[model samples]
Target: MSVLSRLFARHVKPEFGKPGPRQEGGDLPPHLYGVIAEFGKPETLVHAVHATRKEGYQVIEAYTPYPIEELHDAIGHGPSRVPLLVLIGGIVGGLFGFFLQYWTSVVAYPLNVGGRPYNSWVSFIPITFECTILFAGIAAVLGMLVLNGLPMPYHPVFSVPRFQLASRDRYFLLILARDPRFRAGDTFRFMETLGASLVSDVED
Candidate 1:
């Protein structure tokens, strides 16, 4: 079996149950996000992820220069709720569009044009369709941004000097301090034991 597969096999515990805390370290940034371990290779990064997961570090994420297919599974990414949000937005928009036209034509104006009824439901189709598409599109964009935590100009991970290489040829795994098992000092040492070339504290 490959190294990645072997590492995953070792960490087969399905649940991210909390583990005992390690001795807290003294050195911490004013606004600390987490500790990130820099790996020279993608394999090492994947290995580190499995190891961390085994230790119940659920609030962790990985960054790589490019997409790594195996990394997706390692990260335990789940289904997105964006589609549901978009559908609800579209339904709301359609209802709003239909009601607006109904109130304007049938209730308020009641214009008797060419002996035709004011509530021309057929005419509302085009506008209703357009409104549905418009709202759904808006929801998709906003949902994506909100879900991904975008508009964030700054992040502690970016504070790392070598993190810029994440766009070039580096792989990184970050373990957030929020994790129950995360002990600032002990976690840093754990990462070093994972064969990380560099383990740095990410400050906010």
Candidate 2:
């Protein structure tokens, strides 16, 4: 073969025949982090989630292509703490704004122009309002990130090749191995009973 042709073959072969994503376990000793069951229908997934919870699995998460209000009720996560965080942030910001203005007008740079009160309470309102909003917005974002564990570019579930369909048309229920009730073989069998289209172990 000509050198050009041989080089072209080598490059093209890898690109054209690139192996599919590695399977979930890939000859590893089944060091699993969880089991994910894929369902074709959202209703089935919701039922499976409820069943799993009823069966005493605590560390569970559901992935779906779209929002489903009923799913949240099934998952039963407790109330979020973001609102309290925002409220605390707003209160702190408002207090800081009020105090800063108070110090500036009364102590730091006292100005008695037109015999106006040095501690001008009315002028502090606008800054206090702005600061309240600014801090509350910041707290809302940070609290969400902290609560949701954001900036996590990768998770063990991503290792499952079939999981990519979760964003497209599939609903998945993941029962974490860390849950006290989880056993590799038993969980796999139980998931099969939940009407899952596909149930696979996830490796960390």
Candidate 3:
């Protein structure tokens, strides 16, 4: 097996209820390991995120029932530029919309009826404004999804049973031990001291 696969196999547990012979060995290879901690209350979960961040683990993920603004800081996620992208796209769309109508009225079709001027300014405003909104809305949604890497229906972390509770009332902080400084036994021991309800090695 590759080093990454070996590391994952060593840490993540198989299906929670399945019975199998436990493998005994020395230290596991380096790979991402998630340590799940269950909390009864939102405050408890928030505390766990903060505590885990202070533990020096760089790779961490948190699951919660509702949006928690402070959690972004805990995970070290920086400000998102999706809004800015949408704004710029809207500006470009507005200009494109105006040009499309202008070209069609003046050069392409040039339907001058009832002594009306070929370059009609008032007639183009409605369509130009609508196009601006449509493009900007589309850009905002697609940009956010791409920036966040969305549409992933499955994650290795979801293989853990207790982690399923994350969508409900529970909060979870998973620290990936695959980081450069990760020491399997030492990290496990340290989490135990952090008052984790149940700290277990996650295996792939």
Candidate 4:
């Protein structure tokens, strides 16, 4: 074959719908957490959340110095499970306390004081109530912490210098990379087009 034809054939992509073999030892791209955008106002952050949701991005979070009630609905963020957890804990604690009291007075010790009867249901009320409240309070705090992902000393979003201001006055919105619709370049540009003052990558 002619040299010109040989060169052209060597450079041509391999046949029909089949992928060419990758380089033997190429490094993979770095992992990413997601993309984040900084906004100056609460309203703007809300707007961004709405826009992102409309764009079909489901995994979104907004950070502000103080809570914005509207954001709960904007991102389609679900209602918290802490309340339910607390209720369950309270019920369990109450049952345990009552049964323990029942077993001691009626089954094990069979105490009799002033002819008050071995099974004194009325006397157990105070301890049952106390145990219920104690367990419920603990459940509320623990459930909140677990659901909020506490003890996280590091997060990729913290890598952004301006994110420190999130607790002071600024507002921020993040779109996690796990979203099915996320494309780094496209999401970055999309966030910019929504009038964000700054946009940055969040490395995992």
Q: What is the per-residue lDDT of model 2 for residues 59-94, given as tens digits with 9 covering 90 to 100?
A: 789999999999887897766767887998899999
Worst 10-residue lDDT window, candidate 4: 10-19
Query: Which residue segments of model 2 deviate by more than 4 Å?
Result: 1-30
Give stretches of model 1 more than 4 Å off: 1-31
lDDT of 3: 0.69
RMSD after CA superposition, every candidate: 9.5, 14.3, 8.5, 15.5
lDDT of 1 by residue, 1-204 (tens): 674343333233222222224335576444566789899999989988999888878878899989999988888876666787799889999998999999999888888889878888888999999999999999899877766666666666777999999999989999877676777788889899999989998775
lDDT of 3 by residue, 26-85 (tens): 476433344566666767667777776777766667788888878888778656767776
Ten contiguous residues minimizing lDDT sum, candidate 2: 13-22
Task: Itemize residue pairs with steric clashes in candidate 2.
Answer: none
Candidate 4 lDDT by residue in tens digits, 35-79: 899999889999889999999988677889999989999989667
Worst 10 residues of 3 by lDDT: 16-25
Q: After superposition, how far is residue 83 of candidate 1 from its true place, in Å?
A: 1.2
Better of 2 and 3 by lDDT: 2
- Model 3 spans > 4 angstroms off: 1-26, 30-33, 178-181
TM for every model, in the order presented, reads: 0.80, 0.83, 0.75, 0.83
Residue 164 of model 4: what lDDT?
Answer: 93
**lDDT at position 182, candidate 1:** 76
Clashing pairs in 1: none
